[model samples]
Target: MTFAFDNAPVWLDLLGVFFFAVSGSLLAARKHIDIVGSLLLASLVGLGGGVIRDIILNTGPPAAFTTPAYLVPPVLATALVYFLFPYVQRYTSMLTLFDAGGLALFCMTGTIKALASGMNPVASVLLGVTTAVGGGLLRDVTANEVPELFNPKSIYAVPAFVGSAMTSALWVFGLFNVLTAAVVAAVVFAFRVLAWRRSWQAPLAVNGWQRRSSDPKP
Candidate 1:
């Protein structure tokens, strides 16, 4: 069915890639990684999620590999960070914003792609969230840091889930157009950034007897 979104905005896709690449390069700066490593990390985080989703759907070679256009954002992002990270380092919150943008976008796009590939709503949602967080997982693992997806410090995956769930529901109801998708992405970005800023967290395991909330940092 081709997702019925054949005209999906190219700029939106590239914007997501750029945002994620910026975040990944910023992390490389924090870790004191070299320029080559920064470019690799940026590309990995920018394209890793889409590649995972495509593989899961049995699609042809991932779009990141097939489409040269997809490669540009990460390269540009890495270069920008490489030259300007010293000044950019002062704004730590920018990292969160970039990550939130990618998370917001990939969650929705991944869900719709899954649905277009004939996956059920539940499975689509799962893959969608996976697509949203897969890049950060790869970036963290490569950098030898705890993945935000699983880190107890932040409610990262939860926001991805919220976006994926909304996207799935929207599709199921025939409301998943370009405009609506943008709306959903916006909501997700806001949710994720707010969650980070407000120190919102999900409940944690409590000996399998009950769950308990993590204390939000003041």
Candidate 2:
């Protein structure tokens, strides 16, 4: 469960943070918030999940506090969005792709980090899912909207769960490495993007009585 602090994972993590920050900034723009709000939201979205993960792992202070790499991207992304909100909004597809990449990367890394910290496989997978979606959960709550993970409108958490589980399994089999991580992450990213493109959604509960009441008399 020990992890080597190599440069590759660090760079990949930073890349994911940047993408998450952009997605957060765009969401803030959609809410018509000011620059300060945009930056706050970006930071929340970019680092909130990782902070939660680190805290749960009992890792002191969280990586976000110790490293400027995690802190800088969100600020830069927020500034970019603040000046080019309208331009960024026009490219929804691209934004979604970036978000998917971030989600996949975070899920894999979260799982690895948790396992390295001696968590059980189940807990590691759950932490990975949280790392993938925690930021969006915070962003939604801050904006007073239902978290998308709980919403039936889109496929979000499922993809993260899949990626995290896959990563954990690979670790169990001793098949996990940097290359394997990249491949697993790509699978997750593609799966998520495909789900979005195909409008794949998780099913919602249907109350029979409510359905009957809403139906017209035959």
Clashes of each: 0, 0
What TM-score, to 2 decimals, does candidate 2 have? 0.87
97-199 per-residue lDDT for model 1 (tens digits) = 9999999988988888888789999999999999889998998899898898877668899888999999899889888877788788989999998888887
Supply candidate 1's per-residue lDDT for 8. 66
TM-score of each: 0.90, 0.87
Model 1 bad stretches (over 4 Å): 1-4, 9-11, 207-218
lDDT of 1 at 174: 86
Tens digits of lDDT, candidate 2, 9-44: 577678878888888788778888888998998889
Error of 1 at 83 (Å): 2.7
Report every candidate's CA lDDT.
0.86, 0.82
Give candidate 2's whole-model lDDT. Answer: 0.82
- Give the Cα error of residue 41 in candidate 1, in Å: 0.3
lDDT of 1 at 127: 96
